[model samples]
Structures are given as C-alpha cells and as structure tokens.
Target chain A: DVKVTQSSRYLVKRTGEKVFLECVQDMDHENMFWYRQDPGLGLRLIYFSYDVKMKEKGDIPEGYSVSREKKERFSLILESASTNQTSMYLCASIPSGLVTTYIYFGEGSWLTVV
Target chain B: AQSVAQPEDQVNVAEGNPLTVKCTYSVSGNPYLFWYVQYPNRGLQFLLKYITGDNLVKGSYGFEAEFNKSQTSFHLKKPSALVSDSALYFCAVRPQSGGYNKLIFGAGTRLAVHP
Candidate 1:
C-alpha cells in the first residue's frame, strides 16, 4: 500500500518561533501538496510541488512556505508560528501522469501555538 | 471562481436507516467531482469519485454518490448508517482545464449516527 508519512504528529511552539512539519511519501509521485484543516474551512491548500526544487503557491500561501528538496520529502515551514496557525496540517501526493483519481494523504500533524 | 458547496453543516441519522449528504458544484468546463470522509483527528479518506461514464459511483465503506449533470450535484448516499460511519464529510472538485492537482473543497458536512 502507498504511504504518506508526516513526521510530527503533535507539537507545541511559542509565538514567533520557527516550525517545521516534514512529510514523506513512498509513492514516488511527482505531485505533492500541503494543506491546512480548520473546523469550517475544510482543507485549504497552502502549497504544492510538482518536482524536487519546484514549488507553487496555493490559495492560502500567505502565512506558510514549503520546500521540496527531494522527491519523497516535502516540508512545510512556518517562519514565525502564530496563534492563528494552530491547525491540523495534512500532506498529500498523487501520480501526475495518468488520470488517476487517488490522492494519498498522511495521517496529519497537529500544531498548537502558544 | 470554481467551487463546490455542501449545503448542510450537519446531518443526523439513526442506525440502520438510510442517510444522505448533499453537495453541489459550479465550475467551468468539465468537472471531476469527489467525496471524502475524515474521522476525528485523522486525514481525509477518499470515498468516491466521478470522472466519467457511470453517474452512480460506488466507493469505500459502503458509500456511493450519484453525479447529476443537470443539477450539477453529487450527493453521497448509504443504504444503512452505522455508528462507526459518523465522520466529517467533504465534497471537492477538480477543474479539467488546468492544474492537475488543484482541488477546490467545500465547507464540510458532519454526519452523526445514533445507535
């Protein structure tokens, strides 16, 4: 089975602290994405990467940044963690070649900012 | 802008009864619609998708959705509800025009199954 793993399951950080949430997928997929989940908003894409060292901004990319240094690893960064940034972060990936309907997701990382 | 809508914020149903979660989408060009379910404190799980062909798409966990082009609706349905089926459901749309992974999601609907 394809697996997407988020390294950090839970974290607590002070305001203004730099934070990192790492995700790794074994699917060798070219398309990877980072999304934030809130109570009412569902999942909002923060950023996505088509390949290593390539990134694209999504709808809510203002407070977040991402890195795709390697194909299997995609990292989401909060330069300065804030209270509003406290939410469940999800990592997903899909094969770009075919008209595949599946997008595998990581378990999720819950970040709490104080 | 392309978007999807889940009209209900929450739906309540008793065990052994049928249940439905409503969804409608508005987008340019052909739309690829999908349904997902998220258990508490977990990532969203793909339930079903409608790419082409059949309007009735069966998916994981005994869930199915019907794609209605005329109404632009893809409503998820299940014959019998179970207590374990209570979860947060989301409706999403992928535009066929551009951006292969650009998925626009709706404000989810919470399903509650009472035993």
Candidate 2:
C-alpha cells in the first residue's frame, strides 16, 4: 500500500505571511505534484517535481513555489499568502519510468489566508 | 493539447441499481485515460485506467469503467450502487507519446445515491 501524508489538515495564515505545506510519500516515487482545489474550478496544478532538487511550474504556479530537497519529501511554499490563495492544497506522488504509473494523493491541507 | 470532458454535472441513482458517470476525451495520440474518485474533504483516489488491450477495467470499491475507442468515452459503472459510493468523480487523459505526460482532468461529475 502507498501512503502519502500531509503536514497539516488545516492552516490559517494572515495576508502577506509565508506558508509552507509539506508532503511525504512512503512509496519512494520520483514524481511529486502540488495542486490547489477550489469549488467549480476543480483541481489546478501548482507545481511538480520529477526528481530530487528539480521542480517545474504547473498551470497555476504564480503565487506558489515547490522544493524537492530529498526523494521522499516535497514542500510547497507560498512566499506571501493572500486571500485568493486560500484553497485546499493536495500532494501527489507517482513512480518513475512506469508509463502507466498511478498517482497517489495525500489527505490534503485546507489553508485559509485572512 | 489533451482534454477530458465529463458532460454531466451530477447523476442520481437508487441503491442497488446500476449507475454511470459519463466521461469523454480528446487527445492527439493514443490516450492514457484514468478515473479518480474524491470523497468530501478527501484527496482524489485512483479508480482505474485504460492503457491498452482491455476495454473493461475493474477497480477499487466495486467500481468499473469501460473504454470505448469508437465513441471516445470511458464511462464509469457499478452493477449495484451503494450509498457510500457517492462522490465526485474525475476523468483525466494524457497523450501517450508526449514527453511530459501531464494529465488534463475534466470538471468532474457528482454522483448521488439514494436509499
């Protein structure tokens, strides 16, 4: 069984404050992704890391950045949180090489920027 | 640019009856399709996928999906619907030949099961 864990279930931050959401996957997958979920808008990709110390911006990476310091850990950072940045953040990881690799997701972190 | 379309916003079904959530897709090359389910406040879970060779695929929690190439549809189905099966379902597709296989997801369809 694959396990993906998030650092926090809920978080609240003031405007312009820095925020970090952590995700760890036990399956040793090489691909990790960060997305923000909003009603009607669906889940939009924020960033993804294909390998350690490597990161790429996704569709909605304007206010977000990601770090993949190690294989098992991926971190999403909000340099300055804003009201519009409040959303449910999700972390996913997938194995490398396998073309049909399945992406596993964490429980998700609900962040509110006030 | 690969994309998926889930036409229905919501589908209602009675318990013990068959249910379906429609999904259609468009891609340049052979499509790698996937189905995922999301419970309230929960992250999306992989249900099933269609890579090749199989049209009917079975997945977790008594869920199944059929890939129809001619129709470009991969509708999720259940023989006997359960109340616990109600959730938001998303369909995604990626181009098989694309170097960066970034999945494009549909808006999603909400399933409601009544006892």
Best by TM-score: 1
Q: Which stretches of candidate 1 lie over 4 Å from their true place?
A: none
lDDT of 2 by residue, A36-113 (tens): 888766678899989999998898999888889999999999999999998999999888788786788999999999
C-alpha lDDT of all candidate models, in order: 0.92, 0.89
The TM-scores of chain A alone, one per candidate, are 0.97, 0.97
Model 2 score (lDDT): 0.89
**Candidate 2 TM-score on chain B:** 0.95
Best by DockQ: 1
Error of 2 at B72 (Å): 1.3
Model 1, B59-83: lDDT tens digits are: 9999999999999999999999999
What is the lDDT for B97 in model 2?
77
Enumerate the candidates' DockQ scores in order. Answer: 0.72, 0.64
Give the TM-scores of the predictions, in the order they appear: 0.98, 0.96
Most lDDT-accurate candidate: 1
Interface RMSD of each: 1.2, 1.4
